[model samples]
Target: MFFEGFSLVTQDVQGVRYRFRSGGTAPDAIFLLHGRPETHVMWHRVGPLLARYYTVICPDLHPERSPEQQVNDLLTLATITGHDKFVIVGQDYGAHLGYLTAATAPDRVQALVLMEALPAATHEGRDDMAFSLAQYNSCWFAQLHPKPESHTIPVPAEWLEKPLPAESVFAPEAVADYLSASIWQHARTVTWAAACHPIRCPVLVLWAASGRIGGWYDPVRRWCDVTSAPTEGHAINGLHFLAEEAPGDVETAISLFLEHCIPE
Candidate 1:
């Protein structure tokens, strides 16, 4: 009953099999991309909420493919799903992919919602002592020639840290879904990249108010440098996992941004 009205769909794109969840009946569509250590299940809470206003698509990204291929897969997924254009909502690593997708296909992406992410170039450009220390595991993972599944599959309990707001622990099913997917090569394949073309669609940057992103950089200003279109930024009341920790706040921010930026 988590994704009450949603249906699981499996399709082949460019010789690769892809699995995704599709739901809602609106003409407008939204593509939700999950981050590192998570599958489509990361959006379990927010997907259903956004489904009320738009057809929601949440896909499990392949770790072995390059970011370019992944972006193409997403665009092709949209085409096969009968959407000429759609809103992309991505968090962390997925946010990086979303940025590339918008840059790669501006006409097809109506708007972009980037959560807990900055441009790949921005991230590389600002790799400092603090970033290196905070993301040491990520840096190490990137360098590994053959990433180990044992290290990648399990959801580190530290990621879903304690002291969360009452009853906000991530669901067991969701955690299981994440573990089922192979994310061994995601860090190596997706994280570091060259600068992409400037984004033309409207952009909304959301980050955790208490997270390293807000503390490390000015998200709005950084995004302004990469996108030619108007950029708006907001800090949600949680840590890095905004969708899971603050779904209500995340949903509200996205709804408001879409209402103002993308006309129906």
Candidate 2:
């Protein structure tokens, strides 16, 4: 089993049943959120490693909830688990949710780890021909409001119309979970204005060195603009899926960041 000793749990919050995995014995907690086209399984590799030092919570994000509702779910999850202060680590769409969660409850979020995503303000403010052309597919996907369950129905490969990394890069079970539960809701981008309250907790931003993020903008600098607390950024050697392609690097970067921010 990928999760090994992790306990599989399902809890109801706000009339929604949330399925998640919990492991490790530490009092301090860390929540790992997955991006689009994936599930909590994306963190299979990194979660066990982090579990050695912290309680790790990996949850399958509900498909059709507003950003505020999603944040509420996470905050409530922490409360239910008896964690007043915890760290958040999110990727892609998950990064967006993490930002909202941190902003919604700054007192409870001790720190944040965001990968392969920029703050909404940074993205909107910097939108241009180059970015639009490069991210045309993503932009198109954002406009689509497909049925929440549309993702589960596999379409022809040609329908994707975009190149994806080889399947070998991901764990087989993880891929299976993604295929079964991935939803279009992940494509919906949350628009958080730059004028909104800045996140006060420390942040660690990680992006794919070979991906479009570095080529499109100064990720670290842009993140610094949105955070009032200390901000650090790193470029991992991989494409958009940092955790899947470079789990070791991801684990190392997060471990080092958490060590400095939440000392044992």
Candidate 3:
């Protein structure tokens, strides 16, 4: 992957280990934070696109873990990369840490884009979806399993292209990625637990056209109310994995947003 331009560097910040992927050169950095059971690969399309214009760094934050731990990992990775200031883009669990990093040290983050994610709030955060009996049961089993499992499905690549009201929210690639990644279970649980807190930053909440996780609109609104940061919601015409499902649209939105933070 051309996005794998940055060497495999290790960072030990506050006892958290961070593995990062980098592309491009220059000090103006764009940091990518990935969610649970996933690696820097989640930004497969987005990272390279951003790298075309700015230094793109994507790090996998083993979500099933603690924010402090993830933060430590990011801190160490940043130190190793010689990045003192950067823009943070987080999705799902990654979004939580993006806010935490900015809130803990506002100086570090120039801007933040939260994709299909919300602050760490358990009660009623935007990312916290209200699942039905079947959905809740499935999630329970997932939590109970405490590890990733393979999900058999047909036409995996076109899974996202299907219309709303999907029978399954995950595609084969997503399933494989989740199961293979480290800290899968720990990341999902901790992400929800962290959502109980508030974050301060220029936040963007993206909603999926057909939400398979939980009810959509209200949670995003609630998330905006709790976080004093400038927040807006745009409904993407796809499933949860909008980046892969609708790369062009996602890239356009991201490019437009980043232009505000780093003109060029």
Pairs with steric clashes in candidate 3: 63-187, 64-186, 64-187, 120-194, 120-195, 120-196, 120-197, 121-195, 121-196, 126-219
Q: What is each predicted model's overall lDDT from 0 to 1? A: 0.83, 0.83, 0.64
| Model 3 TM-score relative to the real fold | 0.73
Model 1 stretches with alpha carbons more than 4 Å out: 135-154, 158-168, 185-188, 194-196
Question: Better model by TM-score, 1 or 3?
Answer: 1
Predicted structure 2, TM vs. truth: 0.86
Query: Residue 70 of candidate 2: its Cα lDDT?
Result: 84
Residue-wise C-alpha lDDT for candidate 1, range 127-159, written one tens digit per residue: 776576576356446555665333442456544
User: Residue by residue across 166-225, what tens digits does model 3's lDDT show?
Assistant: 655444555555556655544345534443344555666665677653353454675675
Look at candidate 2 and tell me the lDDT of residue 237: 96
Task: Estimate, for each residue in 47-165, the C-alpha lDDT of model 2 and write its tens digit.
Answer: 99889989999998874777888889999999999899999999988988898889889899999999999988767857776676576364545455763345433332322433444
Find the candidate with the highest TM-score and give its number.
1
Question: Which 10 successive residues of model 3 have the least lDDT summed?
Answer: 147-156
- Candidate 3 Cα lDDT to native: 0.64
Model 3 alpha-carbon drift over 4 Å, by segment: 1-17, 122-179, 185-188, 191-200, 212-215
Ranking by TM-score: 1, 2, 3
Which residue pairs clash within candidate 2? Answer: none
For model 2, the stretches where C-alpha displacement exceeds 4 angstroms are 136-167, 185-189
Ten residues in sequence with the least summed lDDT for candidate 2:
152-161
